[model samples]
Target: MAHSPLDPASSLPTGPAPRVSVIVCYLNGANFIEEAIGSVLAQDCSDWELVLVNDGSSDESPAIAARHAANDPRIRTLSHPDGRNHGVAAARKLGVDAARGRHIVFLDHDDVLRPWALSRMTGILEREADVAMVFARTLYWAWDMTIGKEEMESSFAPFPPGRLAGQVMLRDLIRWDTRHPPPCSIALRRDVLLATRGDGALWHGMYEETALLMKILARHDVWLLDEVVSSYRMHPDSMCIKAEAAGTLSNETVSRDRVRYIGWAARHVAMDWRSRLLALTVWLKGEAKLRLAPRR
Candidate 1:
């Protein structure tokens, strides 16, 4: 039996709050959960806690998480009531609510953080009070768990390393005019995340991170680092890969999601006129893609 969110007796971390909380939420990711957790364990920074949220994984993953928790006081596990299969957004919300940290970092079960990731990111956040979040480049790993030399060389951010205004980042993200960091490479202030998330209603579907990023970048400053901080595992089991294999991933589906996100952002995120125009432009482009896509 899995622990319920309503259960007051559910074991969670207590005592002085750690400086950072690393949240890894998953559903049936037994194959890579250990490596993911290992990366966190390998972090040079020790002022952090790990929250593993099992979103109704019907595999050995829950047990694996339990074993890790047993070995380390900094780790704990969570799940929905009766082990319900909530989506990633809800699972992440559960972890965030239970997290006891000033800063938050999200790592997917299939990804791994570099050893100095936490140390470097936390140092930036501590030194820059105005930066609501910080992110570094991510290395996209091949299926064999190795990065190609060319991929490694190209992992650096194209933009200059420095602080960027929230609206500027949001506009670029909406227009798809610039590269954005993956979730694994980001560390944000918990309060800013909480405020941007606001009930997590807009994040239930695909492109969940995009929805969250639009809001955050619209309302807060972000620090961009020109270094790689994590590795994103690209394998057959990844959501997009599986979807693509099944023929369910298409331009139409992407366009629909993009439109939904744009609408949500227009309603939720406070943005200037230029940002709004860029969002409208992106929306039009998505509509065009959907219209031009050849019928299967």
Candidate 2:
């Protein structure tokens, strides 16, 4: 499943390296829109496009997007015509469709990425001959502006034959176990995205990025960046932190998704028993926490 780099500029309207589409999908993130856009603008690397998709906002979001668009030619906004297409998933789909760059960056509007996030990520993508996506370590920026340590750092293991994830799936097993999920640290190739036709339904709501990651793993290798190339804002307004506080996704859903995920991995993916069992164990632990959280 190793793909030759497709000219790095073979996308619909743009090429690689210099041109980038840093997509920031949002609902009602008017409060943080400027900060988010500014993060991308502050990048040391120039020649990037900003695709901002507004998913039916009731507040000042549209105005905010317009204000930025009016000033910057590289920035553009698309409003969700149908109400059904207004969630995170739909907004993401729209963002991907609107992207013209060969390299696609997925960023949350409420989250602030680091100055070198795109530069470093795209650099690795160019260097790594077999990588499908490049993921960097992110720093935790508290409300007090205190940057905490990196959450989950990868081994940065080189790709095994036929892309490590794809082979695991080909063997009928799951190859990934997420101790935690970080949204801002991921950057992907446009062809890898075009392969999926920019379907955000996989990443529609809660575990959207998780689903997207799985799809990418199907055909390519995810190269982990040891450097903290992005910064994630921690606060009460964040949807994920709120979900954790309310115990909405809680644990049961996670446990079930794990079973389903591994099943999907083992059934459709090509992997063996050992990998399946390991994935199962991880899911079971998550289930235990889910079942206990309510009582606690």
Candidate 3:
């Protein structure tokens, strides 16, 4: 049988694979690319490979990534041909296709991983066979709020630390008990990710990570580490911020798309009709709140 591009068992180069593949996807993020790549290099666990995907960046991002790649044998770079910019999801797929690790984690060019992140999460995955995904808390460091101010005053974890630790099932995640951690904070078994691959175009403009998370959650329970493993930078040019500024993403659009995502998840994850109905009800109530909300 011919192997699919998404298949982990496909004919990849034969060699010693890394324990973890840290994929940092970026475009025109020259200012923060160094810091993002630096965080991975500074990891406590050194048995990892850094895959830097340059999605047709016009800035010094490609140059910086190349410099780092030249200096470190563990770093490899990939880019979209012809210098045409592909969106985030396509960039991610490129990295995933070239990954050579047992476990995989996605990092953005603007985020920074804590020094202990790799060792801690990989440790948990190694120790627990049942846990398909392990995610940790993130500290949202707002750039506008942090500039010229004391570092201590700038960042915060929106969710209380230690509140949602331990193994959580798919149903629990769907309940919306807490915010879903960003892609940077979560690590997954590579095989599991490949098997649940969806049409990358579906997530081109929005909800990329959410779609992937829902699929992973469907088949296996995830572990939540109480510690903050990464820092998510929130700046004016960030994707969500840009969408909001352009009026392309509104409360109504978000709610409606979420309901659509829930239905998609229910169908693909093989959920029973009862669970699907329950998910529908949850979103309906959420939609009601948006309707009742006062206009700004």
Candidate 2: what lDDT? 0.64
**Model 2 poorest 10 in a row by lDDT:** 3-12
Sorted on lDDT, best first, the list reads 1, 3, 2
Please, what are the lDDT tens digits per residue for candidate 3 over residues 1-296? 97432232333445699999999989898999899999999999888998888887888888898788768878888876555688888888889989999899999999999999988888888887877888777877766663322222211144343223222344554565335778888898888888778423233345567767766665576776777888888777787666556654454344444555655665555445555667677767756865775533
- Comparing 2 and 3 on TM-score, the stronger one: 3
Estimate candidate 2's RMSD in Å: 8.1
Error of 3 at 87 (Å): 0.9
Ordered list by TM-score, greatest first? 1, 3, 2
List residue ranges in candidate 2 displaced over 4 A.
1-18, 83-85, 144-181, 197-204, 248-274, 284-296
Best candidate per lDDT, number? Answer: 1
Question: All candidates: CA RMSD in angstroms?
Answer: 3.4, 8.1, 6.1
Candidate 3 residue runs with Cα over 4 Å from true position: 1-15, 146-169, 198-204, 247-254, 272-274, 284-296
Better of 1 and 2 by TM-score: 1
| Segments in model 1 whose C-alpha atoms lie over 4 Å from true places | 1-8, 144-157, 199-201, 246-256
Write down the lDDT that model 1 would get: 0.80
State, as a TM-score between 0 and 1, how close model 1 is to the true structure: 0.88
